[model samples]
Target: MARSLSKPARTSLLPWLGLAFVIILCDQLTKIAILRVFSYGESVSLTSFFNLVLVYNLGAAFSFLASAGGWQRWALTALGLGAALVIIYMLQRHGTQRLFCTALAFILGGALGNVIDRLAYGHVIDFLDFHLNAWHFPAFNLADSAITLGAILLIFDELRRVRHGSR
Candidate 1:
């Protein structure tokens, strides 16, 4: 016999999706503003350790395989899209778990945000540079920030679950 899906499960997914959409909107809007305001490679110091800059990433995190002769563009885009699908499925299955679903929602937003950039410009737009006395971290944008936060939350959630002896 086939089991039926519940209405609550369907409704529960909406809030997570809405959160993802908000992240996507904020990511894109910030990118657009940066694109309009900064020329390529331009940097403006915002603090002792922060700057607003413009850069494009053609590959995954930390520019991994970024110089792989352009094939990484579509490959990374496909990877992001695939990850989004899996995250959504997980969100549907675990929607009642607030921390887990929130983490997935953030990741989903970030993935789609980067995916949008890849499709529109063939690269991801990155800014928000942080540095210290000539040593610089890689430049990244809001979407990257969201993804990182989500990953951290996922780890924390797992730790909490383990401590509580819950699966």
Candidate 2:
């Protein structure tokens, strides 16, 4: 019997894992650079609305539950690990879906990046800042940016899928 040629090859896991590693490297490297160059809470203006600053956030985005004493640390850490595991499961199941895969990769990279910080520093290092006269957004880092962008992409992808009736 002739061998069938229609079967596709299996997808490799290297690229996705590499993407996550790159995200973590960039996140940690930038944080280190900021920590070395600036004092905690010090800002060096790079533009009219942007600054390279150093901050250690002991809480989640916008400092949610920041004042809840020490328990927030373990709680957030567990949440991060749980989310990472879920993303990994989804990636394994649906990685061939490009949009979904990208979204998951970004989220995974970001979650691990911050998780590294929590384990090493007991806090997350945030440097990028945006502000206007009399108004300021909370400082954040590369991982946070990636995570937010990933979430937005996931939403957009879902919306597109819904519009196209592709599920």
Candidate 3:
């Protein structure tokens, strides 16, 4: 007979899911504040390199496929939802691996956050902007930030794993 996960093993995934939920909450709340305070294309200079701007992305990171004439909305939404499911599965299997699960949780939260935007408004709302003189980075939101951070953490985790000869 095959053994199943014990109760403690199954419950180990909860903390990571809770972290993802908190990230989603924070991402959505900030997006709400930005929507209430800024009109489309409106920008407020907050520092030498940062500004609060209002923009909607109909595409993925850096507005890729944003001009695909609307198919991207549902496509990205489906993709995000798919990724979230995989992340949850991975979290359940590897919940005891701190760094790996943390990376997955962040990515899961950000992916769902953006997925919510796509489902609710047909686009992802982006407002955080950074620039240098004449060049500006693409505007993004808390969800995007979380995804980026998660990617970095994943890289670090892999490097550490490789260095330490642990799988």
Q: Tell me model 2's lDDT, rounded to 2 decimals.
A: 0.86
lDDT of each: 0.94, 0.86, 0.95
lDDT of 2 by residue, 91-145 (tens): 7767677787787788889999999988898888999999997578999999998
Assess candidate 3 and give its lDDT. 0.95
Compare the candidates by lDDT and give the number of the best one. 3
Clashing residue pairs in all predictions, respectively, total 0, 0, 0
Residues 107-147, candidate 3, lDDT per residue (tens digit)? Answer: 99999999999999999999999999879999999999999
Displacement of residue 151 (Cα, Å) in model 3 is 0.8
| Residue 152 in model 3: lDDT | 98
RMSD to native, candidate 3:
2.9
lDDT, model 1: 0.94
Ten contiguous residues minimizing lDDT sum, candidate 3: 4-13
Question: TM-scores, in order shown?
Answer: 0.93, 0.91, 0.94
Residue pairs with backbone atoms closer than 3 Å in model 1 (clashes): none
How far is 132's C-alpha from truth in model 1 (Å)? Answer: 0.6
